[model samples]
Target chain A: MAEHPSSPIPGEKPRWLDQPRNVTKVVWALVAVCALLFLSDVLYEKHPTFAVEYLFGFYAIYGFIGSVGLVLAAKWMRTILMREEDYYDRDR
Target chain B: MTAIAELAMPISPGLIVILGGLLVPFLTAGIARVYVLLLSAATLVYVLGLPSGEHAAFTFMDLDLQLLRVDKLSTIFGTIFLIALFLGNLYAWHERDRMQRTAAQIYAGSAIAAAYVGDLVSLFVFWELTAIASVFLIWAAGTDRSFRAGMRYLIIQVGSGVILLAGVLFHVHETGSITFGHIGLGSIGGTLILLAFGIKCAFPLLHNWLQDSYPEATVTGTVILSAFTTKLAVYALARSYAGTEMLIWIGATMTAFPIFYAVIENDLRRVLAYSLNNQLGFMVVGVGIGTELALNGTAAHAFSHILYKALLFMSIGAVLFRTGTCKGSELGGLYKTMPWTTGFCIVGAASISAFPLFSGFISKSMILSAAGEEGHFITWAILLFASAGVFHHSGIKVPFFAFFAHDSGRRPKEAPWNMLLAMAVTAGLCIGIGIWPEPLYAMLPFPVDYVPYTAVHVITQLQLLLFAALAFTFLMRTGLYPPELRSTNLDIDWIYRRALPAIIRGLGSGIGVVWDSLIGGGRMLVSATIDGAARNFGPYGLIGRTVRVGNGVAWVATLLLVTLLIAYSAG
Candidate 1:
């Protein structure tokens, strides 16, 4: 077996950051930038006060509820629709 | 202009192009290739120069046949279809197979014809034409698997056309009109049309033919097959029925279901096939939402998808062409030798992933925003999850495994210049549309005011991406990632592949036993009748006994004398 690259430092166990450390850092940085930009748009963007209030309220409640419902529906479908990975194979 | 009109109005020219497709098989390979390309190119020019907002209907022998109508929506789809044909033709120019070339031309012609069709009858005719022409591409592989795949594809596709025909008949009976236009899905006829479109869209359960047949087609054949059929169905659905609440759920399922199959699929081309299904799901969702922005998104997504998806397929085809295999297990470290092909594949991957500054991001975001605008927070969120799933399969998985994973030590030569040229042109479109979407948006059937470059949209999409990427990394680091190997992944196609065939075989045998018993009983009855006849008619029978008649004669005479006396007294 090939030796692991970027092994854990002495007394410091490598977690998600152990391998491809620079790549992980870049990904996280991009994420942070996205979050900051989103917050700025939500708070500072120009809009009618009433419209903003209603839209954001809808986004919060409906988005969360809908996501949960989707997760549940997906789980239910997994039972009925899901099949063995090799379902189409002749040999299987 | 008046003098031009005075001259005999020439035939639609589109018909000529379609008819030319039929003659391709008789031509030599070199001539056929040039003829097919020139015909398609000319058709593209004809469709482009077609006058906008003009609707024409022709009747023959009192049949009132309406063909070749042009509108904004038809123009957009028709134009893109022509471009697709052009690219598909260029990609397949190296293929000397006569059947493939003929099928490709006919497929393009039928799609263009379908777009221009003015009435339901004309639409159905061209719709079935597209189906008939496309199946040859699948069969062109000349393999047992492809034959079976093509057969299933024919059944589902022809089934769709039949359903559409039934719907058209019902629709005409109910509405007393055969003109194709928006009709809500509240009646049986409307519902049937929706189902027909659903089959073509490869919606959820009806989606198996796409994944099953596409990968089984020849390399260039797959590229041509990718362009027309499903997208045409999307256009049809969006045209006739939109905002059907069920489509929302159906579309979401379509988007999400294929990722798992794609992740585990052994064949790279099959993976792309599944990915194609997943992308169609997004377009379906857009149609389901039925807002101006959403509809635009659907059209734009279809446009961009044809580019990048074709690019991806072409790259994989190049790999297959070089190595004679597209199984991921047999391919890795190819990037070291074929850097150009690898780079093109990555561009396709990034575009599909909706990475920042890609075509997918620009178009897909429109639908997401439309969902949010419509107060469909749940639908929007599911779409978000699907976005992440896209990253997992088409975006990351395709590139990572094919290019970087474990280096399987293969040194295949790069794709041919013609193939690379096809990929490059497609890649250029992907980037061009991503950077300047104005031209694409302008071509949409609806007016567009929504900006794609909004701070909120970009930022949220990025956050979703980052988290999804992080999830992927987390899975990999923890050894939870699904390993890439030569394993078959199952989808809805299994119903036809396994269950349906087994049922048919079982039914066949059961019928055979019943038939044997009926035949046995029938033989027994016939033989018994023949035996009885033989016994009565043979020389040993009572009717042939001449000596018995001589012995009875004397007794009869004695009895007759007494009877005659009694009869005389009665008289």
Candidate 2:
């Protein structure tokens, strides 16, 4: 993960990140980590603050849904709230 | 040091900083910078040396005023404010604008002053001082837009102070006590005070001014601006309204709604502003929980939040400084060039997102635990959701689109060395507090009993945050993620900025029409009277002609006869 100084040579080869295969590999790595964390939930001692916490993979599900819901809801909001960058200035 | 501290006994540290700020304009730019830094450091040293008791007491018109109330709560807030003042000055070292330098010092000093003041009257004075002094930061941007935004910001800020003053007047009249303490929501005075605090805390609909003005400030100005105003309000609220039940729901709403706006916000600084509001919600909820642990959580969170939040603003400010744009649509792949800034930004992001070993984890979880322990199930659920949402926008979205997403073909120079040093020191604090929270916890208003590094806590927090990241990846890969665009997404400020003005214009024209008709009718009546008079008394008419001799004689005779008759009757 060492980062080199960003002095670019002319016509240098693209870095590992520029490769599609490496990109796919990184995505898979993230997926694997997420899966492992979700599975490791069974190893912990139960200390439920609420009944809902006892559900299997509850945090994972809630987090995914909450984030998705936020994005989707915000996208819909753009329909009503979005305006030209100069919207405030137009009247003035 | 003790001698110096004793000599400075009666003068509040805040006043020292204010006096120093006033002297900034007289000094040369380079000297001013060093002088402010030294002044802040000296204030910190003096504040640290003092004991936990009231100092600088005086009577103002028969009411006791304590300018320096040194206790665990005020001490912690004061320490952090001075630290932020030093860090902010360091970050803006290259700034030559006298107004910004002076305003920043005065603003930070007033906030520290607000925190340490022992009574509502003194708090009101410092509170309004913070507002009046800070607006110059916004105006220092010197854009037409910044000017107008600063005006709006000033109005709302000063308006909050006005409300606080009104509340203080009412509370004093009713209770005959000006002491700032747990006023609770038992009376109208307390409610008005809470409203005032709510406005500054950016409670839900009362927020927009924060978002409207912060992004419009100068790069260094925004960094300085972010540290003081709202957090001072949070401190005030914790002092006054602890245990107020309504704040629980208010806090939850404050936490939940801003993430939605932040999700699609194109301006990175504005996104940070929304995130700032969300963080305040956590502190507010802790204040509402009202246990010793909860208040400690609030103080701890405020201390940590000021650093990390400033760190975030500093990073974006650096980007805006170098590239001249902080828009998500305009920035990406900055890590290739600005490695240090990118690393520091990630640290800030991690701290704010409450990663297991970051500042936010140790602080925010205390509030969440308080909610759960209090058996507020629904609020706990909403807070957890907000936690995941915060991770999504501030933690991931901010750094991703700015540094790692699409390459923007922008190869700007790295941030200035002073900015890097400021951010580096701030980032170090974020990590340091995360690793050893004991020093921070020790300074809290109460003893701490919570452990943030529990196995269950770490696992659950990771699951929540990582899953949110997974969701982001999915959206990006599927092309479902909304693209950043150059546009304005309206918020509550729309009412004041757009709708209210439009309504006023409509009413004005309506009134104008009525006024025009009324004036026309009056004009016509006057003209009719003049015309009739001309017709009756024209030169050729009977009264105007020379034959008026007999008429005049008759008139005089009648007048005399009438007078004679009246006199006779009276006699």
Candidate 3:
């Protein structure tokens, strides 16, 4: 009689579902760009010859790749290492 | 050898400062306060006016030696140390606590003395004096936390001095000269001395004490604590051990590690402390490379780092004074209330982040360029990464979280006038040095040749900034970046803060159990021995009989026979 009762007891949908679809799309697009940049950097063995040349390009490409890598790594790490903010407080 | 001789004055103006430091505590509070300020100011002026190449020496008892030498390097450090003391005294002037005032004076005096020391022994004495005097500032904060931090700080600092002493003794024994010079890193004594400097410089893991202690110090106490100790170490390193290759890597690690902790730390002052560690890393790397340009970078970076770091701490101290807490989790939207303090903090942030036309941009670029020129590709890359990380934590995170983030609904009044004035003076120095680095460069140990405004350096730096900003924006938009929430960050210091104490307590209890058993066994043994002795020697026992003359005669006859036999054998 109550097979689906827990599904909609009140307004209990996860918060992520509430955001606009465009936000998710943009995030994916950024992720894709970061992956593409990383692969390109690995394949290309050359750096710009002049210090001033391609400065913005190199930074943007590499910085984006690094930031994305950091985010994913941190997310992975949190599953193992993350503790409650007050973990030390109880002992105190 | 005696090319430039001066009158061997026993009580020079330098000694006057040292003596004044000792005498200040005995004076009335009002007079002591004025006298300390005046004395420090006079010392600053005297140091500034000292001829660049002047060297003086004095000896006592034909064994104790004293050398007070003033050169470009010593003068720059000594002068700044005096200025720092003056400002620090002014900041703490309202406190009637004699211990704080006297310790502050001694700390400053010793640092100034250390700056001008020309031999290993003199440097060692002044070095330990600095360690002893500065701990009082930490203790003056008058909290259990401050007490413990001060104790740890003192131990490490004094440990450094002890190491330095051992090194000096060995060096003197080997080289037969105690004169301080560019003793290359070729021997054990030299390496020990380098380690001593490394500890003070807060190289890598040795850095936690700085962050751990500086925040726990009294509000005014923290300002004085910031300037002298580590900078003196840097000066010593630059003077003695420049161009050591390991320093480059150690410096790089120092630059990189602190940013993560700073990024997540809840306490603002603690965050600044971590930033200070990161900034010192840049200076150390420069010293390690030891090119003329790199050394200039190290000196310039140190000069600017001291100013900006002090300014940042002063701003945070102002906030802490108004509000009881300096935790980022508990603070926001203070700009509307304490605009002056916020503005000053922003100047410090911009200068530290190396924004165009800021002090950091001019000085830090020198080191990065030096890294590139030296063909240290990995170090150059890491430093570039660290530059962005600095922007993330110190430049953007500090000011934004404290002043511009969502209002935490706590409205505090602006900082007092004196605090604002201090911030203003420091802010001025930050700007002054950035706009015209020639003065700072000229005062460096080596000649300055590289210009900071080259097109390649500027463009590359700008691109790095833009990309870092873009990355930050991207993360913020995506909600993937970790938000600045109220939290405590774990760092290498956690080892001492949590693990060390726990381990000590654990080991203590474990040992206590074994000790308790051992004591019990010993007591049992003692009781048994006493009982046996009682049974044997009491009136009722066999040995209790009065043997007297017969037993004595037998024992003496045996002894004499053995002695005669040994003598006959020798013959």
lDDT of 3 by residue, B1-571 (tens): 2433454432234465777888877888888878888998887777666665535666654534545677777777777777777777766666678888888888877887887777788888888998898899899888877898899899899999999988887887788888777876888789889889888888887887898789989898899899989999999988998898888999999887777667656788888888888888888899899998898888888878888888888888988888888888777767767999999999999899887778999989889889978888788877877787777678767786687554655568998877887788889888888788888888877787878875545555555555565576566666676655565555566787678989999999999999999999999999999999889997876677566798879878999999999999999
Ranked by TM-score from best down, the candidates are 2, 1, 3
DockQ each: 0.11, 0.45, 0.11
User: Which of 2 and 3 is ahead in TM-score?
Assistant: 2
Model 3: which docking level applies? incorrect
- Considering chain A alone, report the TM-score of candidate 1 relative to the true chain A: 0.43
Please give the range of 10 consecutive residues that has the lowest summed lDDT in model 3 chain B.
B3-12
Worst 10 residues of 2 chain B by lDDT: B540-549
Scored by CA lDDT, what does every candidate get? 0.77, 0.91, 0.77
User: Which ranges in model 1 have alpha carbons more than 4 Å from their true place?
Assistant: A1-92, B1-16, B61-63, B511-571
Q: Write the per-residue lDDT of candidate 1 for residues B1-571, one digit (tens) a residue.
A: 7654433133344465679888988999888878877888887777777775434565555444566667777878888888888888888878889888988888878887787776888889989998998999999899888998899999999999999999988998899878888976888899898889889989888888898889999999999889889999998988887787788888988887777677666788888988898899889889899888899899999888988999999999999999898887777666667889999998998889887788998888888778878888667767777777777677767776676554555668888988998899888889888888899988998888978886555555565565555555555555655555555555666677777989999999999999999999999999998787667766765544355666679768878988999999999
DockQ of 3: 0.11
Per-model TM against the reference: 0.81, 0.92, 0.80
Per-residue lDDT of model 1, residues A1-92, tens digit only: 01123332255444332356554575567557545643544553543212433353332233234333333453344545555544554463
Q: Deviation in angstroms for B404 in model 1?
A: 1.4
Model 1 lDDT at residue B254: 82
Displacement of residue A61 (Cα, Å) in model 2 is 0.9
Q: Residues B1-571, candidate 2, lDDT per residue (tens digit)?
A: 7764664466788998998899999999989989999999999999999888888777769989888889998999999999999999999999999999999999999999889999999999999999999999999999999999999999999999999999888898889999998898878788889999999999989999999999999999999888899999899989998888888899999999999999989999999999999999999999988888788889999999999999999999999999999999988878878888999999999999999889999999999999999999999999999999999899998988788777776777889999999999999999999999999989999988888998999999999999999998888888788888899999999999888998999999999999999999999999999887777777765555556578889989999999999999999
Tens digits of lDDT, candidate 2, A1-92: 11111223457556666565677788899899999999989989879999999999899999999999989999899999899989998956
Q: Model 2's CAPRI class? A: acceptable
